[model samples]
Target chain A: MKASPMVEIKNLKKWFPMKSGFKSKSNLKAVDGVDLHIYGGETLGLVGESGCGKTTIGRTLIKIYEPTDGEFLYRGGDSSEGGVDIFSLSESKMRPFRREIQMVFQDPYASLNPRITVHDIISEGLRVHSMGKSREERKSMIAGILEKVGLRPEYMYRYPHEFSGGQRQRIGIARSMILNPGLVICDEPVSALDVSVQAQVINLLEDLKHDFGLTYLFIAHDLAVVKHICDRISVMYLGRIVETAETDQLFDNPLHPYTSGLLSSIPVPNPHMRKIGKREIVKGDIPSPVDPPETCRFVKRCPRAFDRCCKESPSLREVSDGHFVSCFLYD
Target chain B: MPKFFYKRKLDEIEEKARPVHINSYRQLVWTKFKSHKLALFGAVVLIGVAFFTLLGPLFVEVGYEDMDFSNLFSPPLTEGHPFGTDELGHDVLVRVMYGGRISLFVGFASAVITTLIGTIVGLLSGFYGGIVDRLLMRFVDVMLSIPMFPILITLTLVFGSGIMNIILVLTVFGWMGVSRLVRGLVLSIRETEYVMSARAMGVRNGRIILRHVLPNVIPIVIVSATLNMSYAILAESSLSYLGLGIQPPMPSWGNMLQRAMNYILGTTTGTNPWWLTVFPGFFIFITVLNVNFLGDGLRDALDPKFVSES
Candidate 1:
């Protein structure tokens, strides 16, 4: 924790304004208040159920959705500036920093520009950043990065429609990594690919991470895939981070009731274990994010919730070394 | 330093040695378009008709405005005139060919103007998607609600009837449909991941729209443009029939058709001069039909789902 963090997000909030009748407005608190740090060259997995704002956190960090409040900082490899206050910087001023941080989108089908050739799609980042001296240099760089991401060099000549789901994801990966960004936010990079191809893409990502010295904020709803690639894990519920811990530590000892419920839901493969294991399935649809209550967001859904859980909200508290949880049980 | 930053000499050498697969997206779309038999036929018809409209008049010696009182209502293959002469003794072939130029010009000019204005407005409205979208889309709705024909007639009356005025009026009314169409496309394109990824990569907003959003919308634009041209021609013809478009001494298929209307009663009497109405009316029909066919072909060829599914 003492080592200088590569990216630090402090109580970042993003609320989308919704029109409510005439002359009134409401806020959908997609990412209310989130705080986390990703160290250099580490893969931090942001995990939550489908509407829990995991994607919002990744987007907010990349400045896709401007932060509503709080400080967001990025410790650039060039340490002389200390840390750039990303949220404070104007969009024009933030442009240069964008080249240092890129994103690999979730849906490979929708990620690559279908109208463009694979070369243009992958090299678009390079062309935008004005990375190389000439178009030829960028072409060479694209070919090199394409090969690095496990695609053939000549494949760049083809359009996205010509490739399968896995090949398209590789093209998406090459695009993000082409600029050699310090932080690459992979928003469910393999969720759209086949199970067999998912492992190949995951392994390719791991290989690229080492070869490029890239740090990642991998967002996924699936715990098993997150476990395979992420070094650390942060669990989110509603619009807040309920727990954050080392991946193995969080799996071994889940502090929050929500975390335990999530872990218990993972289907055990063995027949005997499946028969004997009692699955913890929470009931009821997630409450609306519009004007959420002051109490714990998960109170109505938490199986172990008590009187105090209804009255107060829990802040993320360090229960053990590098293990943090937001439940009153931990406190 | 990471190996990707600086290109290795070996990598460059290997790049040159590798088997090159140079299949560009333009080539792919073209190849697909070529495979569509109907689209190919439509393309040929469109090109052939356009060429005839442009150059067919040059080969004929008789002027469209020249009148020969002695040759009035002459049938086809008459001396010193081909395709016969009209009731006014004007050469039907020359007038029809000349009308093609004006009709085709008005169609294309208005379509281009509409597409340009519509693309800009739609891109701005859809990409920004806030008050701008609300204002532009509402304006489109207002435009859509008005009776276009009445407004066009009123505008042409105020503006004076001429080819440019007709083009301007048609353009003013025509752009709304394209804007609405482009706006719808942009709304979806703006949400796609590549756009967000482009935004995250430090690409300027304008570049994202041009490079990512516009290219995706081009196929739709092409198809719409062809359809728009046919609509423009039809509108121009209707206006001319009402005497609000393309005045006399000038040849427009619309005005020519209006002139032909005078000869329709001749048919009831069994004395009809079929050359006047049939030839101009036939040209209008064939031109519109061919353009529409081309539009249909483009829509099929450019549909990404159609391409991938096949």
Candidate 2:
């Protein structure tokens, strides 16, 4: 991999301040610390259960929520080497980068403005960036993108509510990709659609990814969906990345106990195979992110926890050529 | 999933060949609004009343202030007076028509002023959020706490009785409700993902509020403005009846009502001067009723939930 990565985030943290009058202020550490590197045209899957902070990572990386701590870097082209430190850039200075990095929100219903037409929704980015020469040129560009996203150009005139869930997701994808963004942060884009429509959207995304050389931070809770599209996978526990590796490698041999437990939870089609395969059942609820314990965040629910795991948290370390894990077992 | 792939390939080919059609949110809203029967009726009534008030006086031969002593105390269908004459022999029809102009002007002017101020305050407070929000909301609270009529009375006394002064008083107090209304709406709207998307697009704060937010809030603003008109008209009438708004020789509906009371009490020349009271009271009633109807219709038309339901 001689080509410089598109985005490199090191020890990224986003903490929300909870303070009201007389009560003492405390930070809710959503994305405590995450290190990730995404190559030019690969979909990096970020998997975690609800409230595990996968969404926050995507948002913080996009500068929607300012990074509380750490550095986010973006290398624009092949030879223009040294990556731009996005985390440190002022809002005005960050404008050009925002054009390169766009996001597709989860709920299609909530994401696209109901008051806006599909044409406006898809072309808003172009308008914001002041792209194209005229309205006619923009319309033609939008029409072409609409067709590529599996939506007819005619549908561009319609409002969001007029479209089906699958269609709305296609519109959302078009909106994000209209700028020909280098890196797109897909925040559970298909999670709100019906099960039947999910596969169509997923295929559309995959086709779009191949058609245009686009990188993505695909965040979702379902490992099954992530496996189909993501080349590399990063599993999150609480507010930290516990394990990361190539998709096939992560699936076959999960390094962290938390990752293994997550893999086991995915149901097998054959009942006989299900019984034969050992399922890891760990107990206890996920601890509160606000004032998290000093030990490993997943230690309470980890079946393989020991005395060392209870006292000191393990930072992520490269256990193999490409695989990284954050646990005492890896140490 | 495999079945979806096989089925969708054929649909995609056919779908792509289709021509584009133009549509817009404005068109959709207009279509939705047009379907509401009562809203259409209200619009018609409003237009009719406004037309009559604005231009009806041009066709009438009698002057509002022309006092014909020979026609004093004359009933309806008199030689020259069709609607009849008041105790002062003024044409009741002409006076009501003239009063409508003043009354409608005061209502609309005050409502427009109030809506503008309220919207600006709400946008500033709600979009900026922190201390600006607190300060503006507290001001609204303080404004709301003042007894409107009594303060208006005291202020009118200090300022002297005039049309502009009454409008100013109404506008000062009227804006609080609308500001609170707009602030509450903006608070919820600001949290929505569309607004977030706009921010992520690097749209300036002012542009976001104007383009993304203001359109969403316009329907509600319009509804409040229409309702505010009724409040303004009623307030002006009350002030005028109290001998404060649109003073003597000006012929406001409120001052007309004040003079009508004299006829009602048998203190004036006429034994029965019902036209003096009836026409002014009727015009006020009609104007307020139509405005309320328009407000109700606008509320239904503007409501997204209502549009979906229908």
Per-residue lDDT over A1-331 for candidate 1, one digit per residue giving the tens place of the 0 to 100 score: 4588889899989999988888568899998889888999899999999888988887887788888987878988884657988889988888778888888888988998887778888777777777888877787777788778888777777778888999999999888888878888888888898899999999998998898788989999889999999999999999999999999999988888889889988988887767454566777878899889899999999889999999999999999988989989878
- Model 1, position A49: C-alpha lDDT score: 91
lDDT of 1 by residue, B133-218 (tens): 99999999898788877887777768878889889888887899888899999999998889999989888888999999998888
| Top-scoring candidate (lDDT) | 1
Tell me the lDDT of model 2 at B305: 44
RMSD (CA, Å), candidate 1 to true, equals 2.9
Model 1, residue pairs in steric clash: none
Off by over 4 Å in 1: A22-24, A274-279, B6-20, B23-40, B78-81, B145-159, B267-269, B296-310
Candidate 2, residue B277: how far the Cα is off, in Å: 4.3
Worst 10-residue lDDT window for candidate 1 chain B reads B16-25
Off by over 4 Å in 2: A2-4, B1-37, B68-79, B146-154, B258-277, B292-310
Q: Ten consecutive residues with minimal summed lDDT in candidate 2 chain A?
A: A275-284
lDDT of 1 at B65: 89
* Residue A313 lDDT (model 2): 91
10 residues in a row with least lDDT, candidate 1 chain A: A271-280
Give the per-residue lDDT of model 2 (tens digit) for B31-51.
Answer: 667887666777787788778
